[model samples]
Target: MTSEELNSNTTSKTQDNALGPAVQLTDEELSANPEYVLEQTLSTILSRPVVCDEESDVDQETNALFTDDDDGDNADGNQRTSNENNRHKQSDSPQTGLSRWKPTLHKPAPSIYILCSLMSVKVLAENLVLGVITDLTLAKIQKYYEDNERQSQKEFAKFQSVTSVIQGLLGISLCSKYGHLSDNHGRVFVLQICGLLTILGSLANLYIYKDSTTYEFYSFVFFYCIEALNAGQMSMVAVGNSYVSDIVSEDNRMVCISFFMSIMYATIGIGPLVGSFLVKIFKGNSFNTLYVALFLNVSYTLGVEFFLSESRTVNERRESQSQYHNEVLRKNLRKEQAIFSKESSKWSKVYHLLKMDTLIDLFKPLKTLWVPKTALGSLVPRINVLILVIIEMFVGGSVEGSVQAIVTYSMFKYSWSSVEIGYYYSISGVGRALVLLLAVPQLISFLKRRNYVALPDSIDRIDMIHLYLFLIFVITAFASMIVYETNDIGSYLNSLFISLSAFALPTVQNGVIKYASKKSIGQVFAAMAVLRHLMSLIAPPLYLQVYAATAKTFPTLFLYIPIILSALSLVLLQFVKIVKDHDMLRRQSEASFNNFDEHINNYSVNTKPNTSFDIANNLKNGKSNLQSNSIPIETTPLFKKSHFTGKDNIRNSYKSLRNSFVNSNTPSSKNSSLDKLKAQNFSAFNVPPSV
Candidate 1:
């Protein structure tokens, strides 16, 4: 018999024996098999495929549950058969054809080396000029006061305090602004803008340092104000860290962070040596470091502008901007509807939009810290995130507060020159680099492999350990400085050999970021930056003032502040809780299920047109060729075979279904089934009910 005759005969046999069978099938099986009488009836009525969990194959199904398997080796045979079947199906799919045409236009992402290099250069440049700023200010103070030592120290302290205050106030807004901007525009855009600001700040530094004799002390203040613009180093660190977070997965985030931080520490160690060398090259001119800094800034800025690509994708930018605009539109509509129902004045609308409440809304980014619950109202304890942020801010500010104080203190106590300060930082930098590059990674690996530390808890545990080690070393160093009248700089550098605490910054950041979503990362970092800047604004002046007051009688008294801050941070550290990796996976699954529910209300299937048979004529003639000899046209499945599949396809399918339903001229009775399908509970698709 011909193929068409044989297919029709087989289909007729299945339909005729449907009632006489000893075993029975449910409505779902009857609806799924096109050869079944019930499916034919339903398809004839609706001319649409019924939604089912899977297609039923009745040919291989047996009434007997117990089958004679050749010593259970048949199971292996069946598994092999299934694998072969899958391979055949994959071979027959259009994916094979599509896979052949690989796109050559695709470019590899820029190396992490570039980012590391950029950060190192930036750090080195800043370090090179760090001592110059203070020294120049002191020089101007001395020139003004005719070498009056006590008055010069007092003025220098005030200058430091005023600089911190101005920088802190401006930095908070700038960091917040750049964080939002990076989300919308791109990371590279923020990086480039911040780089240019750094360049300008460097130029201002060079100009001021070159003419300290010609200009007054206010020039240094102007330079410091310029440094605060666009958040300066704060913006760079936040945005750079954000970029690293974007490219690396959570699993390797710590390692990547450690890698870059090691580079930063290395530069910190080397920068002073280079700066002192350059000063000597110019015959003891501290201003020479400013020239090198300017050069490095220009080079790095150009490299960033030309070589670096935006980390945020086009789709992400569109989605983020869309949500923002939609939110604004919604708020405007609500306000107009509520207050301006009778009033048609434009000024009223503008005033309502630009009120003080709206101004206060700018700080809404800080809400990332207190993520009280998920979208579905599941409680997510993120208090640890807040704790980590406070710890970082307090610790970072305290560390920064030590720099100027230590610089001046060493100058007064040890009679150290600018070159000696350079050597001191260089040694400390080497110690820190060794810890981050070698010790941190090894310890993490050892814990994960040997101790079987859970990945989520590992970071928290390691961070705490590092913090403890840092605090211990810091306390010991300060105690020796205060208790013993240590005149030797070597002893100070020797005490800092335990710079293993250098791992604390990156690890703390890594742990805090575990609680953030991909979209909110920038805002979270920005909020942290704001807090750090606030501390910077507060801590420096306090340290400087205390040092100035005690410089004559008790120079070591200023060392107590960092020890206090470190102790407080360690106390807070004990309260932080670890979020397990599996819990994160569960949250992701819940999010995906939520998305599916949102899309399934309008779910659709797109059927391919059959060239051999007419779908339109089959409907019109009250017939279906799905069980006929003619090739059956297949409907495209909801989610096809793609590793990167997501909700975009679901949304598109929903739109297609809606359009087809609206444009169809079918009878209302036939369309009723489609409407019923839309209204059916998600359980119909065998999807588990959400919690």
Candidate 2:
């Protein structure tokens, strides 16, 4: 009846769909026809229609529909339907040796989307205000309409370009740091910090330039500081994606992320409209609009600080576990510190900081290649995978860069005003948002139902994204060439292209984030953010240069640049092969560790050192070393009566065995931890056969 009620029913339907045919099949019937039952279960679970040969026995429900027709005609109808179903289930069995890559995530609660909505509103307002700032303050912004070759226009352009580059440079180091920090600390904490800093920087900018008559390099300093401290828009997008990754399952992840991104675009679409409304209300006073945006940003930060529930309150590695496990880990870690570092004080913060051992921390993620449970191994089959992903983002960035160039083209080619550009941007945003929110999910669902695509074991649901990207870019590029001649129709088509991009871009980015574990999502997103910022540094300058060079002579051919970049991205995507499943490797590692731990634990309990013969002989030989009061034999809790003999080394034996058992259970480990424990500790305890 209501949207909430509709959502509830829809969620129930999906949940119901996930169950296999066991609910419908009787135990006696299943036992009598096990193969048929298996087939039915597989069909239900895989969401494929029933597939059976015409000669095969039909269940009564299936035969009922065809009862109205002749038996021969009914059989023919059934045959066609069954054949199509059969075609869909070719890769359903594991013996087929392949299925697509889609890494599962821990399902988070519903409150996260509310958080996304808040952040999106903040971003929409923030970016909209930033976009209008240069328009409001730069002297050349108005002069572009009056003078064809204005000196003031060139100076303003130079200033904007230089500052954009500087801001990008400033974001690079800090963006990477945020990723690593979020991974180590927690995503929500870093996100809140980023939000706070962004508000501070924006407020500082307002303080500097609120009443200023003109833009200056000094005014740009506040913006640069924002980029350096907060990582600008990249921080929000990166950490926001990380937050989503923490909660959504693999099945729903792509759609959920798209939905999240759509909300961002949707809100961003609303931002300029709101700003434009404000401008009209104040009779086009852009100065007051900037301060209003600053005040709104401050409110968003306070909202984030108070309202956002942390996605990872415990250590991210143990986020899936209950609070009890988190306490257990902390307790174990404390015990380990107390035992290992005898001289170190328990409360020594300086000593703990010194002991963090960050020498190889930057390269710590690379160690994940050895962990088979994770998707990282398959995600990066070769260095080429990383290269392909980065190149794809780079090309995508370059194509998106055309939007800004188009604004300038609207000024130069169509003589459109800033207000018109704002309107055009809003329209494009809506188109993009619609495609992401409505169209893309429908497409995925349509394909998912048919099950026609043979997704590789290491690839994801939308692996075709890069291939489609090549087409989208080429189309957009071709459209851009004729946009000047085509007028309104051309502009609408270009907006459509941007909308198609909104639908497609998240799929490509999802491929990268999907491979990362919940713990590493922040780091992966951070890498993406850094790449995006790096691309931002390159794309804008390059696009402007190309536009400036070709504006009068052949503005139509300007679309070819993005086409070439997209073509290169497609080529890069082709070389990136999906690797074999590495999750099995992780499972095997877990099994081995479990086995090794069990064996050691059993050995500690079951081992009985036969010092009895040696002790009896020592006593028989008139208390050689056993009767020596100086040689105190410390007791093993399990082997209390067991005594030292020969050289009175029982204390050494107990200490080594205690060290072995205690150290093995510590959370972190060196390479070959089990093997080293076996060799060093087990050997010390496993008494010589000669004895």
Candidate 3:
């Protein structure tokens, strides 16, 4: 038979009644005619509905799958019945295929992986380019000094110090601003801006050192300015962390962040190898690295624009914008209604510009680190936030200083080339990355499985332990460096120790998140970025200058800086406390109680009286009996309306009254309940005393 004829016959039989038996097609006809076979197969498959756990999304797919036929009311009824059957089946089975994958697309794993890939590529490119630039700069300075060792070294140190200061100064404001913007706009938005800036900086770097015959020191400094405009490297770190925070829940945030951080460090380790290979291929030319860096930056920016979804929802963005605008309006209104007169002259304007308040405005972003008083009026959150900030500063400074001190010290003392220095950093990076990736997650999982660190309180304590261990490792490593100059073996041990200290920042961040609200995550990380830039400003000058001055006498004197910072951090970590959000707990309890009360009230009001109960009949008799009383019921105090102070009391009173009425209607109890009811007070129920 023809395919059309076969399909028409099958539809006619099926549409007569949906409850009818199936029409079986002959196997020979199904096999012999491809058209009929295909039609029958599709009809069978489409007739059976696609079932999934997520009914809402899957229902859309199911609707789109079915095509309507123009055959009349019978066909329409059959189609409707089929849809209903599909829905029923969907309710029974779990979701599969694309629908299942869609739910997890927004989950933490995919987000972390995306972020890691983006950051690793960016870091890898950066390390390659930056290493080449540093070597080129050193070579250029050596020429100006005519190969004078001390003079070239001093110039390089000064160059490093100046660039760091400039980057820090710009980064302080930019990082905080970008962070605030990310909270309102989106994390991906900030990342895109930073990525574009990074690409520009790479282009500028290429232009500055395009020619081997001349070096543009001023131009190179401007290049640093461009990078620092988006808070330099720290901006990416802050935004990336905030992005992770947006996706991951508090329970798993620490582990995910550590893993994220580990990936970045792992990239740091791997970047050098890639960079060195590039340098080797280009025959010692570093300029090619900039091209590669620029390419990576462009690719990353495009990826972010296309692939990454915004973490903040439309409602969240709107709410954040509303709050921000309202705050700005309030501030503006306050300024307009000033208690003091406005400045009337240029001198006054100058005075205003130099005012302490004006200076304080520059540091206003740091206020985010101080937890504001909530409705609960708790001091613990504020204290914990402060402690976390303090720990971050000390620990962050030490870490930053150690990086500079170690690199400069290695370069000068061991006379290591750029490649050798890269190798050293790579070794440390690998060690850190492995521990954070492999060990940290397993440890967290083990603890969770054992039920040791279950709640936020327990998590806080674990963070403290991690911090303590990190500080101990840092102290031991740096202190050992102070005692004896590091050889290859010493460097290996030091890297191992430093690698173990990787737990500090991630743990400290977890603590910070615990104290801060979810909305303020961007601001919190921005404040952290600010602190890191502040360290960058202070650390480079202090460590590099100290190393420059004492290189010949005691190069290891700068090592003391990190040791001191770590020691101070270790001491301050003791003051950190774990406090639950009492306000949130109280709100949750009150809401639960209200929900229960509402349910009980709804039950009491809507429940119908059963014909088996004689309460309705009794009410009529009691009313008539009361009306016939010789003493009027109007003057009786028991008949007056009363207010119930407690809902619980009202509910209990109603339940008791209901039970008494039910018992009074029964043949087994009969008048026994009536006597008890007469003795019982009904004032709590706002009814007259029982008759």
lDDT of 3: 0.62
Regions more than 4 Å wrong, model 2: 1-110, 139-151, 212-216, 223-228, 317-380, 452-457, 465-488, 551-554, 578-670, 683-691
Measured against the true structure, the TM-scores of the candidates, in listed sequence, are: 0.64, 0.62, 0.66
* Model 3 weakest lDDT span, ten residues long: 587-596
lDDT of 1 by residue, 450-535 (tens): 65443542245656666677666666666566665666543355336436467677777787677666666788778777777777
TM-score of 2: 0.62
Taking the tens digit of each residue's C-alpha lDDT, what string does model 2 give over 22-63? 123223332333223222322332242222222222332223
| Model 3: per-residue Cα lDDT over 481-588, one tens digit each | 656675645555666788877887788777777766566688888888888888777766677788889888877887777778777877777766555544332211
Off by over 4 Å in 1: 1-108, 133-159, 206-220, 284-290, 327-364, 374-380, 402-420, 451-498, 544-574, 579-581, 584-691
Give each model's whole-structure lDDT.
0.59, 0.54, 0.62
* Candidate 1 colliding pairs: none
In candidate 1, what residue range of length 10 has the lowest lDDT sum?
57-66
Lowest lDDT block of 10, candidate 2: 91-100
Rank the models by TM-score, top first: 3, 1, 2
lDDT of model 2, residue 50: 24
State which candidate has the highest lDDT. Answer: 3
